[model samples]
Target: MKIGLYFGSFNPIHIGHLVIANHLAEYSDLDQIWFVVTPHNPFKKKNSLLDNYQRLEMVYLATKDYAKLKPSDIEFNLPQPNYTVNTLAYLQDKHPDHEFALIMGEDNLKSFHKWKNYQVILENHHIYVYPRITKNIEASQFDGHEKIHAIDAPIMELSSTFIRKAIKARKNVEPMLPKNVWEYLDEMNFYR
Candidate 1:
């Protein structure tokens, strides 16, 4: 099966996330998209993060209804300061039958070179990139354009950072996340 790995901290899995994943599954060759929840991203600030398990649960709640979208706890079992290369290697080893692909936004595309062992990742895996607000990937520049593909994923203009700020402001987050996720966040006083 062709599996697209949508890796993220998912501080809170919002509608924008679901919208993109759903759009990918509907319009692309991917059979499913796994939401790989990172307990801690090496490149991101960990001090502001919620508990890993709590973040995982929010992901679970956000994606529960979509059979094509699954919440993965792969990083929860791996060592700290999570690295994409390491996680990719580990998943590749464990799921040899399944062809894994990287699903990321164009913003990440610009910094792909700086990622740990990015050359290996580019050489080994296929990347399914999509456009973000400020970044648009030019596929022709990459050495492996055939491997690095882009898709037309609808934008919600909503971000985890934006949503977190909204929650902190005690503003309505209804438009930001799915109904269940919004309800859960309010109930748990998440980001409050």
Candidate 2:
């Protein structure tokens, strides 16, 4: 099976996330898209993030109906400040029969080299990149551009960071998240 690992801190799962996962599963060779819930992202600030378990559960609720979409808690037991290369290597070792690939935005592609053990990841896995605001960096920026693939999907201008900020400000972000996810966040008092 071909699995595409979509890593994120899904503070609360949103429509943009579902759209991208659905698009990749429908249009690409991927058999499934797993939302790898990272405990903490090295590049991100901890103060802005919700609890990893909360975020993971929200992803579970949001993706319940899709067979091709899965919420992975594989990183829960991994070390904090999760690194993509380590996760990829761990998954490969654990699931030898399945082929795993990465699904990220063009923004991540631009900084792939700076990621921990990036060369190892590039050598072993295929990377699928969707268009993002930072995509204008051009392919020449990296020697491993060939390992990265661009997908044809509608670009979503939403990010979990932005959504969390909106919630903190009591701004209207009902449209930014899935209905039940918002309810769950409220029920759990996440991000408060």
Shift in Å, residue 174, candidate 2: 1.5
For model 2, what is the alpha-carbon lDDT of residue 63?
A: 93
Highest TM-score model number: 1
Question: RMSD (Cα, Å) of candidate 2?
Answer: 1.8
| Each model's lDDT | 0.87, 0.85
What does candidate 1's lDDT look like per residue over 126-169, in tens digits? 99988877745455356357789878888667789988998899
Please provide, for model 2 over 1-192, each residue's C-alpha lDDT reduced to its tens digit, 9 standing for 90 to 100.
999999988876799999999999999999999999888887777777678788888999899989999999999998876688888888989999999999988777777778888889888889888877653466636535787778988898888778877878888887878888988988876665
List the candidates' TM-scores in order: 0.94, 0.92
Positional deviation of residue 137's Cα in model 2 after best superposition, in angstroms? 3.9
Cα RMSD of all models vs. native, in order, equals 1.8, 1.8
- Candidate no. 2 TM-score: 0.92
- lDDT over C-alpha atoms for residue 91 of model 1: 90
